[model samples]
Target chain A: MKIKKNIAISQSGFAFDPNSGDSFSLNPIATEIVNLLKDDKDEQFITSHILEKYEIDEFTFQRNFDDFVQMLKHYQFVE
Target chain B: MLPTYNIAITGLNNTDNPGPGVPVIRGLREAKSFKVNIIGLAYENLEPGIYLDGICDKVYQIPYPSAGSTAFIDRIKYIHEKENLDFIIPNFDAELFTFITSQDILSDLGIKTFLPTLEQFEERQKVNLPEYGKKYNVQVPNSKALTSLSEINDLRKEFDYPLLVKGKFYDAYLAYNPEQVINHFNKISAKWGLPVIVQAFAKGTEVNVIALGDGNGNTIGAVPMRKQYITDKGKAWGGITLGDEKLLELTRNIIKQTKWRGGMELEMIKTNTGEYFLIEINPRIPAWVYLANGAGQNLPEAMVNLGLGKEVIPYTSYEIGKMFVRYSQDLIVDLSIFEKLSMNGEL
Candidate 1:
């Protein structure tokens, strides 16, 4: 549930994992989530932030967030 | 003023399983210290580098290593007399033995070459992987060489199912059973000669390191890469430079212990448990060597400097996260160019 400290995300939503040398292009939502995670924000804070900023309901945000986090885990971006 | 050296290189076949020649030339062309007149020493007339404009100033069809050193060196002598060559870089694996043995004769002719010594060359061969691993303190899979089919039945005792059947110089197949092993053995042996290697299968992700050793136990340059895309021939179609310190440390250790000279590619597999096993050590610059250049370490340039007996400071760093994706394009050429190379042996 914790993002690796060395992950570098650019303004263009390009994410680079310096440790594994893997690069990824994140969408706006994913980029925001990663930025929030970098700032030590908890999942509850991220959920509320997304719900308040976007038109999506709480349940949809939670589901998408879970899926996104799973992908981050699969790519070894998060520990 | 930068001195221009006449350098000859081989293995210009830029096919699916590409050779290091084209990329190496690209590095040399971009060299900061000197300019070059590239001589293309090709075994076949149609090798892509021979046809590529501006890559080779002149191209000559040379005899294969199978022709033995006398004929090989004689052709080189002929080329040297005409070109006044300063250095030669032979890129193919099958030709390394001839080059290593002829190092002294080439040196006597004032043609400098940075190559591993014959002992260094022989000890890191695929057939000697086990001993090489032990001597160099690296982890290598248990492997046995089979000269005949009679040895196949006994392989099961030492290795489990889905082991690797490998040729001496090239090609490898995963054999699930004895029948497949025999098939691969016959196929590989027919192509690459006797003593096909049977190695225990190590399941993991394949990673590679392109390294240059200074023959004095110093690593001139090293860059680790992971294959982002693999062709059916098991060649890296695309790869990226990595920031993995462990792989770099391992490369430095091997270069230090072996006092390995010249360009080498270390093919390794990183198991899920985070252990790295040395799979194969290719004794020349890899086809993807341009990646090293793009990542900030121009190893081919360093190699030329070393060949010329110039002092070269070891490259301290390369930009990680740099990726190289390969592509193919058709080149339009006239019939006369091919005719000239085929008929006159030089163009």
Candidate 2:
């Protein structure tokens, strides 16, 4: 999915599109994913990094991480 | 400045509402160009949404009447006296009825409301609905606005299986055959206390077009969309964003023809004949306004700004392939219903 060029990201997890004049506030997990993408983190790297940092069990984290990735794909927010 | 142009939105407390009106209000305030204050008014006690807890300027809870038109009218009058609001925007089905019921009273209080006149409101009934669709050469299912249930048996003889028993502003039940039609019709009629609209079911893809009109029927911005998922409550649960020049033009023409203002969501079905069949015109904000805002055109904000005499820059191009998913709400409902049916061995 192609991210619109005019997309703006705030450190506090607020996303805005200057082209549309629309804004979205991302939850903590969504914020993390988008931020990681902005920093050019690959899927494997994001997953492994999250695994080491969070206290969640591997199965739960992987399921949620995968679901979020699918959602990003669904909304055309990411490739 | 202008005391922030006090604005109040009714129906924020409705159960299972997936509206983005509150979010749009917050976004406008964040811009800080204009002094905009949002007062979320609710008839029922609801768990406070994200906006109610200080994101908006204030949150006012209004107690609605238990029953009848008198109770509804009294609640709006009460809200007006308590808030001294500049303008009021009704956000749900019930509240729309309330606003329309007491529009003149609200106007007398110097509270600006952007909806059609009482005559226009009455004219948008089932009998007149199909005519509007026909004028644009849009297909509409065979429907009759019946005052009595006896008319159903007569109409069913001509029209075949799979009919939709619809309320002018309430419930809609899909009745597969004559037996089901009688059952659904009686139930809905008893509940809504209005003439029921019996329509032939059109099996096709569902699409929606929401437009902002200038009250003269000139549309400022319109978004054409296709439903990706539908909740059990018949709300558009998810949608794939698409736009058509022709669809937008037709929508504008209809609104202009009707002299419609405020917000409207036009429901359509893309039929097998490659035609879009007009289903219903809901004269208020829809559940999918969030998708429209996400793609482009912050409709709620645009309408509020336009109401305030602010110049709203028009945008023609929007991202075409975007989609929106509400998650948890849609997902849970779909799963739970299917699970129950499966457990019953019905699926």
Candidate 3:
């Protein structure tokens, strides 16, 4: 899945979709993931980065990451 | 130097179900091209806007529309004599008929008003929605106007169980069965008089567009909003501007077809399948008009310019994603101000 290019996520985790005019607030981890996605980072890289910085195991990170990605899709933040 | 105009406005009742007066005034106060000295025309002594600081330079109590055109015009003339009013904006639906019909008299008195023509106003009434839809080639849910109790039995032939029982001027209730329809019919007719309208319930998300039309078939401004929080009265407590091109295009088309003058709010239902059904068209500015100003289209200011016979260029863009959340606050007022307005009809 690819995040839409026009979605602007501020450093404070305020996400705005210019096309739909919908706004969202993301938690820090979600914000980091979105920033990584914005920089064209692959899901594997994002997962490793999250796995490295946090206490969670790889399996739990993968499950949570999948759920987060699903949420982004539901909000039409990703294509 | 920006010109300063003396403008009078009505509908100052800023309650739960707000009149557009306060927000419209807020927009006019923020106008960049011109300055305004606001004269508030109120029907009651205690309208919140009358007490609000810096909203109106002077507040004059005017006769309600129930008092005929003669009394209405007489009061307006009295106020105009004092204020030398350049323009008047009547914001209530009940009062619009009086103002629209008396446009010539107001103009003769050097008081300009930008309002829809009587024909435009009458044709878009809730009772005439079906015909308005047909004439304008817009999608409208099936509806029938009933003048008696017996008509409720016949509703099943056309509409489903869940339908809307609506009053002529205001109020709408969703009735789930024949008994509920009869109940609402009596309640609404008792309040707003005959020919209650029963409309098929269009299942969808309710979206609204606040728009302004210049008399010459041009849309000066149009902004679509989706209600984020809805009050029990069906008014939006919070709404966010949307970038829905289809909705904006529909608004523009309606304005072009009707050559609608003045400010209007289009209430519509956008279904999941992407079809839009025109529901109600309010012929005056809505209470949430400040959202348009916040989104970069100062419709009220544009409307004031249009009222002065100025050539206003249509607004081409507005920042999307702007949101308006309504809040209430208490204002301390001296009893003498209220007493003066009550006794002398001016404050």
lDDT tens readout by residue for model 3, A1-79: 6788878889999998754556899999899999999888999899888888989999889898889988998787886
Stronger candidate by TM-score (2 vs 3): 3
Residues B199-219, model 2: lDDT tens digits: 888887677887778776677
DockQ score of candidate 3?
A: 0.49
Per-residue lDDT of candidate 3, residues B168-244 (tens digit) = 88889999999999999999999889989999999987889999999878999999998888889888899888888
Please give, for residues B1-347, the per-residue lDDT of candidate 1 as tens digits. Answer: 99999999998999998999999999999999999999999888878888887899999999989988899989999999999999999999999999989999999999999999899988888889999999878999999889899989988789999999999889999999999999999999999999899989999889999999999899999999999899998999999898889999999999999999999999999887779999899999999999999999999999999989899999999999899999998999999988888899999
- Candidate 1: which stretches are off by over 4 Å? A54-64
Q: What ranking of all candidate models by lDDT puts the best one first?
A: 1, 3, 2
Give TM-scores for every candidate, taking all chains together and pairing residue i with residue i.
0.95, 0.69, 0.91
DockQ for each candidate? Answer: 0.70, 0.03, 0.49
- Give TM-score values for chain A, per-prediction: 0.94, 0.74, 0.94
Q: Which stretches of candidate 3 lie over 4 Å from their true place?
A: A4-6, A17-22, A32-62
The CAPRI classification for model 3 reads as medium
Clashing pairs in 3: none
lDDT of 1 at A79: 64
Clashing pairs in 1: none
Largest lDDT belongs to which candidate?
Answer: 1
